[model samples]
Target: MAIISIANLLASYKSPESKDMWERICKSIGSQMENLPTLEGMRKIVTLSYNHLHYYLKGCIMYLSIFPEDYIITKKRLLKRWIAEGLVAEIRGLTLMEAAEAYYNELLSRNMIARADDPKWTVETCQVHDMVLEVMVSKSLEANFVSLVGGSYEGMSYGSIRRLSIHGGEVVSEGSRSNKIATSHGRKNDIQVMNMEHVRSLSMFGPEDNMKMLDRLGELRLLRVLDLE
Candidate 1:
């Protein structure tokens, strides 16, 4: 007997179309509905919203899938990569970096990413929610947009990787022990460069030998996005 408008329910959503999609998602999970929304239901709603983004926005968001879940992505690092990848369009009155910032803010307003708390870092930091990351990773891989190298693997079997993401602090490829791609917690100062000749975008985390790594950038001739910080 109580009346609650859909607007009140999805007030955070920016568009009416997105709100309608969320309603459809709720109905799709009808019988299973509980006091709290199920993760799958939320997943569908997020995915639907993601699908409605502008192509540029979609590309910018998908690029973050290269980072691991719960990882704090620095705003400077992200915007630089987006600019390098040509994802940020030039605005008449704004610099590329400024345009990139606008894109970042757009994503934030849509609730796709959350700002992180960092006291010392000069640049702002942000992170995606676990649910949003799950969808991003799934869709990114399906589209062959990026390949994440994590943990230990006996053998490497994959086609050409256009974008490569290496997780910091994890030993990658059990059989292939190459320091070139190995990450040391500031214990080692040597930069390790992998033989991903075709990789265009390279993102590394937790690597301290970044200055030395810059010396090897010439190896990746097609490199467009190089995010080491």
Candidate 2:
């Protein structure tokens, strides 16, 4: 599946030099496959593909990290969020929405996102491959592009978060359920606090009971997107 996706991406490149670069990338991946585990080797391919994406497209793809695994993302919602986050810019004569749509199509052409099955046979939603999402999440963390709470990132500490995504049963433990928490990992020092003033987007994916989490929404003053599911 990784190879097929890489091949599809390569097919989308019209330049001979681009084709050669991808061909060499494929060979390098093949050489390392012998020494790496199956999942690791596939991650290598996806990581390479991600690194080779256009700068803007890379940002667009990294935004997908906000979504939980196997979450069906709607085209309209994703595009609108991109525009709201200023990740999408008008290109040539294209309007912002058109430009965003073009980015969506490019991602599809590269097989970075898979179309979700719809009973109406419409391509309105898509799902990110697990391996692909792994790479995205890794990159997002490395850049501090997003600070995720709950799920695998529970209890993690970050500095001046730019975008926040919460995935768990509750926003935070009742003891520290207020807007701020200790920034130091495993430390109760209140002097250093987790800052959300810079957070531009907040996505929450959990139960309706978690709605109380919004009471502290004032913390994310710069928030532009509030996705709840």
Give the candidate number with the greatest lDDT.
Answer: 2
Q: Which pairs of residues collide in candidate 2?
A: none
193: Cα error in model 2, Å: 6.1
lDDT agreement with native, every candidate:
0.66, 0.76
Residues 2-77, candidate 1, lDDT per residue (tens digit)?
A: 0111222244455857768677645644533343356555666667667767788998999888886688888887
Tens digits of lDDT, candidate 2, 1-229: 7778778767767686786877787687777687775877888888878877888999999999888777888899899999999999778899999999999998898888888987764659988998898778777877889777765456676777788787665444445412222222332212125666788888888665255457667777787888776
List per-candidate RMSD values in Å.
Answer: 8.1, 5.8
Supply the global lDDT for candidate 2: 0.76
Backbone clash count, each prediction separately = 2, 0
In angstroms, the error of model 1 at 141 is 0.5
Q: In candidate 1, list every pair of residues with a backbone clash.
A: 180-192, 180-193
Please report how far candidate 2 places residue 55 from its true position, in Å. Answer: 0.8
